[model samples]
Target: MGFDSFAMVDWSSGNDTGPRPRKDAIWACVVRQGKADEGPTYFRNRELAEQWLLDLITTEIEAERRLCLGFDFPFGYPKGFARALTGSDDPLGLWEWFEHRIEDSPKANNRFDLAGEINCRFGGKGPFWFNGLKRKINGLPKTKADYHSPFPERRSVELAPEAKGSFSCWQMGGAGAVGGQMMTGLPVLTRLRRTFAGKVAVWPFEVLDTPVAFVEIWPSLTLGAAPEGRIKDAWQVEQVALSLAGMPIQDLARHLNVSAAEEGWILGVSQRKPNIAPPPLRNDCFALPAGVNWTPVDEALGLLRERLTVVTAAESLPVMQVSGRILADDVFAKRSNPPQPNTAVDGYGFAGAAPEGAQVMPLCDGRAAAGIPFDGVVPGGHALRVLTGAALPAGVDTVILEEDVTVQDNHIAFHGPLKQGANTRRAGEDVAEGDLVLTAGRRLTPADLALLSATGVADVPVRKTLRVAVLSTGDELIEPGGTANPGQIYDANRPMLIALMDRMGFQPVDLGRVPDDRETLRDRLNSAAKQADVIVTSGGASAGDEDHVSALLREAGAMQEWRIALKPGRPLALGMWEGVPVFGLPGNPVAAMVCTLIFARPALGLMAGEGWQEPQGFDLPAAFEKRKKPGRREYLRARVRNGRAEVFASEGSGRISGLSWAEGLVEIEDGARHIKPGDLVRFIPYSSFGL
Candidate 1:
């Protein structure tokens, strides 16, 4: 069945441009069943427009009519962008990702900075370009001439013959840069998806099994010339909405059935073949291959690295403010370190290459101190009094330390046979001008800041801090300090995971806890997608009846159950929640902590632009012995004392005390063997995992 109502929104990403109806502002129109077309409504900002739309949707829902909503901006970027930006090829995931990163208000927004940030992820070249900001944005170029897109310039839908004149979503400004409209518009869509939840479906991506469907539209496709008195944006939206609403049910259904899941398809662009149903949406990038059961730890790690890419964008910050940030592009010295030749110490400066015996030279008229140059050059046989960090005067190639020379009257006496340029700092001695000071993907430290500052780099381009949301699920869980009823236990995983993320330098967003209800978990996850780059949940990861997290993900067609060949933490669920990556760990505290450290740590690091982090381990003599089984790797909570590794007394997954007791973990490889007291074992300290 087709929609009974149609709404078209001509969106804008700009500020509240004032009360008068004008161009470059939001214009929306709706045509409802059994009613004349309503509203070519004008809104100054997205907030008002969104509220009005929401109210309209509520009214339509009450009337038991389905709505087809359309927005002007592209719903997705060109193919491959979603995969590159969010580790998934699903455009809706990109929508959720943008929902979290883009900050929009009436008067101001961070679209330019956000666009540049995305460009920075592509090494600061660009798939996005053209800055409209008064000041410079780090990776975003000011003109199309400087752009070098790593992905295609346009989506396939935009290239369709009927859509020939449509603007590329990559162009950010200077005439028809729909990219700004998209950056601001997608978040609203994401919010609408959340607000509507189960009742709404995004066309071309999900099957239209809901009461409402949202699709991308180009008003120009159906609108001819506007009436002379009407604002073009308003006229077009009204006309388009009415046209779509008036179409035959069969024709509308055909339009709705066409698919382009990765790069969203625009309605009315191409004709669909009769009786051929559109293919189902492509499998999410996180979905595992069929028939794969238990995966090895190494294979899991490899899969994570292969599938995940940086989700956070980059921003330009002052060098002093960039410490602990990952560098987005290779930084070059603006000018050389020691910029020009200068004195290394308070001394008498003169030309070198004099006689090998003791010599006396007449002094120049003035002294050269730091930031103050001597007025005149030093003559061949003359010296000038110079202080430390003073630029060398012309005709002077060396300096004799004040303590090494005897100054009397207008002359200084010192021994010759001195090396040329001795006691004089050379230009570019530390870092030459235009030399690469820091490479891309490097995490800046305080020392790195000093080096950058010394090399005349005032600003640094760095990846934005990755924000990870921690969630815990289980009906039996309660917050700490809460009075627990029968069967309920305190939730330990949320705090532990949040702390772990913080310790690893990611911004952790506490999503608190949700009980074992699928709907509640779904709502929480939808909300999390708007606030975090990744989600780490400690429970409901298995396929058990109460495992709502994994079950909900599977229902959404994005879940992969990886029964890893490891003790304590075997059921690891990897999935996507509204496009945001979700890592599902075991319910037991010990197993949850182990899976997170062994898997999520390195994966999150890569997504944060820090690249993969392999925990360093050292072989140590075993202080405890046990028989090991083949086909499964194992990690035991252990502490080193007197050069030997000692494991916890119990290897139980429920022992939360062991996490606190151990200083490190002793790893056992997948093989059957008897580990004697003197056997060598690989010990990885907690510090190595950034504890």
Candidate 2:
């Protein structure tokens, strides 16, 4: 018989409000291997919940596996919340509180008036010595009655301090601290844990103190696209339950229907010359396909840490550091903007000295600003008038302000002597002969272009724009430009998906809509792969008959991974067609966009030389109520206000309006079936994904 390694309990606090039970209060226990048909059970009280949890452990789990029972509540509470509420600096205030409240008698050494005394007393060594009797009682349950000790047991109920030993009380803060305020799920979980020891193990989310582990799953079918019995898919709950039963990694991957190597093949065709005879089919056109693994989103990304490289080399690009993105490379300056020395202000440039009290006459050398400059310099006490940013003439050393010099004759006299090199602009100060402005791999901006133009540069060396091909699938879909027939829907995916590619720095080639035709798909894919670096087609990536994109992928090229175990975009396909990466996205607009943000975006980042391109997630309070199915993760459309996040009420993957109303997305993984309002949930802004 196998050890009953899985323990489950439906947990919840009786005082829960805010329109939903706490997520930690409900538990789904797996007694043995194989998928559990039932979902999580709800509990109204801790006593009833703990009673049922203990029974499950005793009956279903074998003695050896009994210790692996996982409660759906928090095991270790945070130490901070108690300090914040009780105004006690000591870390053990809550723990001491437990000791005082649960003790056999209220007068049992009323030193600190600890809270969980009855709970911590069991952790002590000796039988909470009744009078002078010396006995041992370590494993007794918190609810156990008076000691069962035999010989010479006294009637006095006072607990000896020595019996307590070094058992220093500590507060179980964490989520329980939040629960302390609302008395939601934390206390119920605590009561359950204290009721049973050594029969359960609590595993928590990476940073959470609660024992619930969030698992995200992907699938091959949409929520309601296909009938119930027809859906063939695996969920995250199945993985977690099976893995906890001690399934090996390789076996688990295989059980999840993932392949470790490439076992298929693909072909490509070259362009033909016009008026030339058709060439015979060649053997070189066919080759063995590349092997790619279909894995969970987390697992798939975890493997690329050591195997990926970023490319950023291009020709004729300007100096990338100073100019930002290089508009063009190896390009030369057209001509100097200011062909001569230029003045920086409106003043007079004169040579030599002026006569005493000799009023200088104002003579126009010329009007010079940025584009125009004075041709000749002032010679022999002659003055050349200059303006701000105007080129100063040759041989003029001093410039006097027009207001300071009183003009009476053909010459000008300064009320005060002019300072040399004052207010004069020099030629070549902005740029000298042949200078590097921008370099390759630099993204060009308006400011960069201005600097280059100022330096006498034009027509820069920019890398040829990366050509990207975008296409949409699904027989039920109709082009937005055309009239919609009965039972057909207009296509918002093409435009929305194309806009995503555009913002990501791609020159998009809209391939229009592709019906569920294999031959047409094969031809279009072959052509697009040759012309574009990436081919993005939304819809029809599933295994259904109407979902023909995967089949067309095999006909056009080799596919690496198909159907990642993720929600929203589970039926995603990653393949190489004619040397270009082709992404077969889910047909639903939301799924297509999400898949692009998650899988396609990262893959594009890899192609475009970015080290990483993942969205930044922040933990915020939930503003609205939301419920989720266990075992599958979801990106709930949500809006954040005043540091709190509230998911949209109509957060269905097929709903487009929800996406529009959401300011960001809340990512809820497995183990978290429902999020209560005000709970801190992780969210990513729409702008972060370049939306």
Candidate 3:
């Protein structure tokens, strides 16, 4: 169903929390009872305002009416802010970063102090000015003259191409300055994401079509053009709501298609055109902070290898038992494969090089069976019968095959002369003494064991197996094979990752599901860390995550790294928890699988002491066509049909079956996104990855 009700939150600028009603706390306007011309109901504080909003949403749901929620603050800053603070370009990256940095409650918060600290990180005393406190806050400017900002005064969204006259987010406690509101506003967004995760669709970040969708809006855009005599705030809300209600569905769709991932879009910015589909991401927005560069697939693979320290601890195992395990040390041949020269083929062994053509040699008295070599030295001009693996007797330097000579009356006749080394296997022919055989960090295969056995290496050293713990977080998830309620799905990521790790030879410890509760998830993850060398979690890793596993990692002083330039798995989170490395994958089943294989798999290998082993991919022709943007790398789930790469029909990452349907992934390079039929793309087989 389309949106049936509209709501807006006019956030307050007050910094104090008191039991008494706040004069400028938070005000909410809702189009209740399907009446778009209705005025707003004032809320005195954030606590009451949010509760009332939730109640309105619940009421709408009961009546089976979809709702559209709008808030006045910017959803995010311009691009570089995310890269500087969180090493990622995802807008939610900023949200989670802010979540950890800000401390807030219903009564009072450190919004001004937090702004000052943020300004310092970007170059102190200027980016954030306007200290709204009774006393001076260190580093925060008391007057406009003291402002010294390291960055530009306004963001890209506040300048040309977007909306003009939008104030800087760095302004705190000043007229028209949204800095304080944003500091508090983001936390509210996070809480809402957590509270109404499954039901609410956050536009531009998540695809719309859920029961309710929330977008960032500017009241000034509409209120500035309000009719005369409608200058009141409540009256403005009523008129804006009525104007929005009059818009056709198709018109809203055009506005929904906006180019504002980091900085959100205005709700009614496309009424005239009403079908303003977003253009391809322009190049100007790609400019990120210095030292923060896009990581290509090969470079990412190299980085992973650089981080994986070769396993130092080694254990000795019998050469036969070491198969399927990685070597921890280099192995040398104890002795050559052949201690003495032997015949490489069934032939006659002569004592010395034969004369030029038609030489006659007396046949040996005893044939040289493989195990029973002739004991007596051959007489001059004589030959001995030899087999493929039979040892050559003393003074035997060449072999004449039976097919090349005729034996009659205990003598052999030859038409052609024999060379000294013809048909003769020299000593150490396969391997020389003390030669390097198998190197450390090489996984033991059947062939490796055979080589070790042939060289007489009795034992080999290998590293211990790495322990990996897995968990899936979300309230809308249930264990696979269990009955699911409406809007619930099975926990595919946990099991999928567990299997992926197993294929790579790591010991996967299943820690199971964690509900959308912060404390419970933290406890469970901490416990998993103790039992595992590496921990993996799927879901609750996104910026919009209600139970934000990424935020918890930040809270625990974890060193989280992410914002990789990869498609389908951009939301991946990597960090260390309680000394154990953790990989937090996106909740989408396909994204979880892709991130695990492309990113987590290598990191896990490093923790296990395995040096870089990149999954092999080969170039193949594309059977379908696709157009993608530049900068980010893309991997399309594809299968080989008619010897050509065919991607899955649907591009949605949530489709788990696509992973199963795919035989491999077709990798498009960082900048090359356009694909035509017969175009060569890198295809990485699932088998090559041991999947």
Highest lDDT scorer = 1
How many Å off is the CA of 680 in candidate 3?
1.7
The residue-by-residue lDDT of candidate 1 on 1-691, one tens digit each, is: 6778888899988889799989878998887752336468899988898898889878888888898888888888898999998899989999999899999888989999999988998989899988998899999999877569999999988887678889999888877879999988898888988998998888789988888888888876644445446787887776567556545455466567677879888887774456677545666322333433356788777667765679889899998789778988899999898899999999888887666899899987888999998887677878888899999999888888888899889888977778888888889999999999999888788899899999989989999999999999988999999999999999999889999998888899999998888888888988888899998998888768998877765543333545677876867887666556789888888988999889998999899998898999999999998998676789999999999999999998888999999998999997887899999999999988888
By summed lDDT, the worst window of 10 consecutive residues in model 2 runs over 260-269
Candidate 2, residues 547-619, lDDT tens digits: the string is 7777655333233345455667767776545445678888888888878887776666555554456788888
Model 2 clash tally, residue pairs: 64
Among all candidates shown, the one with the greatest TM-score: 3
How close to the true structure is residue 256 of candidate 2, measured as C-alpha lDDT?
A: 28
Which 10-residue span in candidate 1 carries the lowest summed lDDT? 284-293
Model 3: lowest-lDDT 10 consecutive positions: 222-231
Candidate 3 lDDT over 1-691, as tens digits, reads: 2578877777765644355533354656676433542466666566676678778778877788888887777777755677777888788768877877777766677888877777678666667788988887777887678677765666555665336667777778867668888877777677767787788877768877787877777766534333233334454455445435434344456567766666555554442335477655647433444445555556555544543344335799898787767788889999897867888889788866776888877787887767888887877677888888888888687888879888889888987765678988888988988999988778788999889998889988888787789999999998779999999998878878888888888888999898889889978987887787778898877556584787776443233344567778866666545545568888888888888888877677666666665789888889999998887888889999888899999988777789989999998878857789998988999987766
Q: After superposition, how far is residue 363 of candidate 2 from its true place, in Å?
A: 8.1
> Which scores higher on TM-score, 2 or 3?
3
In order of appearance, the predictions have TM-scores of 0.56, 0.45, 0.57
* C-alpha RMSD by candidate, in order: 21.3, 25.1, 21.2
